[model samples]
Target: MRRATTVKFKYRPHPKQLQAHRAQVDELLYGGAAGGGKSMFARAEAILLCLRVPGVRVLILRKTFKQMESSVLPKLLEEIPEELAKFHASRYEFTFKNGSVIQLGYLDKDGDLENYQGPEYQLVIFEEASQFPENHYSYLESRLRASGEVAERMEALGLFPRRILTANPTGIGLMWLKRRFVDPYPPEKVWRPKPSEEDPEPGTRVYIPARATDNPSLNKDYLKTLNRLPEDLRRALRDGDWSVLDGVRFSSWRENKHVLKPELFPISLLSGRKVIAVDYGHEAPFAAVWLCKLGNGLIIQYREAYAKGLTPVQQAELIRDLSKDEEEASGEPIEVVADPAMWSRQDAGAHKTKDGSPPVGSQAHAYQTVLNRRPIKANNSRIPGWALLDEKLRIREDGEPRFLVYNTCRDTIRTLPTLPRSKTNPEDLDTSAEDHLADAIRYGVMHLEGKFSNLDGLDDYVDTMDPMETYRIAQAEF
Candidate 1:
């Protein structure tokens, strides 16, 4: 009699991979430097889930079909033992004898998600998730539900619904992914999501940051190739530095050297001019940055207010409230510089009054009415403004940057470094990205640069009032 053959499969996962497999978080982001074996880890986890739990259904996604076929599919096929599972090429799925299935797919377009509407997946893995848009990712998150039977089976096997994502720092979805996963907590630290109105059923989130050095299996030649890449790409891929992007607009931005601790530069030391820069948006996000110029020609971004869906009056009130303490202490109003677009009147559709009559005035005028002062129009010169800001970000001979952002300015710190260069216009930043805070910073920087450039002599202007009052007057004049 012919004996039945038994196939034994074994996978020795790296430490990071083991951590990811053991993590009980609902959503886990395993990202960072390239060649860290992220894809291998994802494939192994997916296979294990399919093998251990009957009726387990997993959806593995890539940005493009070709990518999924050429890279992920080949590795998956190589790893799965022949006797354990059968690959159905037509459906792009693997079926194990235990009734579990692993479906390989791609989401290349915005509307691609509609194809997956009815299917519920116990595990959804997004490979190169940063390449996908935020809306697509959120839509996929809604489909991460399991049937009662499947849930019961998974629970019996110590498995749960998991959303595993792997990505690098560069991509269109960089901002939202960073905000959602990488920015909340330190690497390898698991935290329960805080409940919020928008996210009532928030789940546990974890970030596992890996570097090229972490993967000993990576070939030395491949390491050399990564090292030989341009400075930005090298930092992003080799060092796993999220702050640096491939085509970053602000090459001068160095977070470690440019960002300052709040204690080091206290609000009490804010002696120079104070300026508030606003980039208004109702549909997108409205961003406001408060900058304080010190006596040593250092411009410190101390505070920020970034929100969306607020009316002009609401934004004005928020700005006023944000600056209230400083304004009171200084005994004068802080200078407000805003986007030039705010001055343009809008009477087309939504701007109409309750009775369908044209609205009273422009957004800037309404803001002024609520703020009790007219905000000066920003220079709105993109190239020059960016140049000035870039110059300010440069480190001086004394090892101090001319411009420094306080750690509290999270939006600015997060968005500024990630802003990419415009493909059409290399000189300017890509405005389509999350550039509101960067725009505000540019406006503040331009205002300061323009104000100081016209100054004939520093000694000519003198004030008898206290330093705060004098600085306030100077700001108002500017």
Candidate 2:
């Protein structure tokens, strides 16, 4: 056996780090704004755990291999003293003389979970956990089991298995992470999971929110850099507000301005032209939004149906049922505008229809067959559609937004505010988020804009120039 070498390092953890280290929980989320020293805190905890427990195994994971190589691995090397462990470059791990091993791992794609199939670790840390989907995070939790020998050693040392996740409040996984970690408790409070069917051995889960102010060691320039971010991004990163997200396409979406009380917009007043905008998805969410043009030219989204795992026929049935009463009262067919992708019949395999004949090869065809009306294909241009929606969402000089959503349209109201900006096209919305409702809204708004002229009576309340054109001009000036 190799002789144990003396390990020496000094780490003065701030209050947030101290809270994280002292958390006695099965899962702990040390997350919040940028410059919170989350990465350094995770490294220190992994090192201290390995030093105290012999024959222990720790797995530290980032979302991508490039991140593991560039950010995580270099930090581990700098923090762990030379005398403590031997670096095995090939394996991307550090093996200490006391038999504890620290593995630096990456899980970028779905298939990357295969690399950690049988390894058991006493502690597993997910750096930037919000960057990964919930399925990837769930699969990783199964690998947190310990071997019998490791368990015995842990029992002797009075230490239990733990999974630590550190992240900022922006990513594709933000919604689920917020529901899991942040939503469970008030800020800075420790939360314990109650026993449930899914979680039989309900373990303590704590969330410790830290901000840029929590770490005095952060450079002033870095704080300034964070502050210099866009308004939504600055709030999410600097203030760690989960309700807001970075790169939001509809920055003007305020609950007070855009969302209306159900009683405020009576359905009786929605007697004008009505439309149903559908964004079809079987694996992902299928969104159908019911919108109507009020006489005042303000668009109200009064009803919606958003769900997943339903066949096109079932979706059509649900949509018909949702609009049944409204259609009956109006005695007129509600126009349907759907995603252009639904109109494609190419390569769509066959299925049995209700009458036992071959099914229509496309979603649009199926909906048309069921509803007895061919739906209008929406203008799917990304930038123009998004711009139209942005125009509707913007509060004009008279303090009235063109678009208003009823509180009963919960999914529409919930998802519209959180849609992030697309990286590929800065002007478009991110499709990875739960953006089906937003897509449906875009389709409805664009179709309405194409069919109807601008509201006639707005001259008294606002300027003659189009608000959207003014917005574009302001953007150009900036």
Clashing pairs in 1: none
lDDT against true structure, model 1 = 0.83
Tell me the deviation in Å of residue 448 in model 2. Answer: 4.3
List RMSD in Å for every model shown: 8.1, 8.0
Query: Please, what are the lDDT tens digits per residue for candidate 2 over residues 1-478?
Result: 9886655877999988898898878888886788888998999999998888888889999988899999999888888888888899999999987999999999888889999998888899999988989998888788887767778888887789889999888987787787788765766677677878998777778888888889989888988999899887887899887767666777788777888887876888777678899998989999999898777778899889999999888998998988888788878779999887886666766543465432478778788888877788776655556766777788899999989999888777667887888776567677887899988988888787673223334333224445456446433421
The residue ranges of model 1 lying beyond 4 angstroms of the native Cα positions read: 1-6, 196-198, 344-362, 366-371, 451-478
| lDDT per residue as tens, model 1, 108-197 | 897788879988899999999889998888888878877777899888876778899999988877778888887767888889878889
Segments of candidate 2 deviating more than 4 angstroms: 1-15, 18-28, 51-53, 63-98, 106-118, 130-139, 152-162, 169-208, 216-221, 230-233, 241-274, 292-297, 320-383, 395-401, 404-435, 447-478
TM-score of 1: 0.86
Q: In candidate 2, how many Å is residue 221 off?
A: 4.9
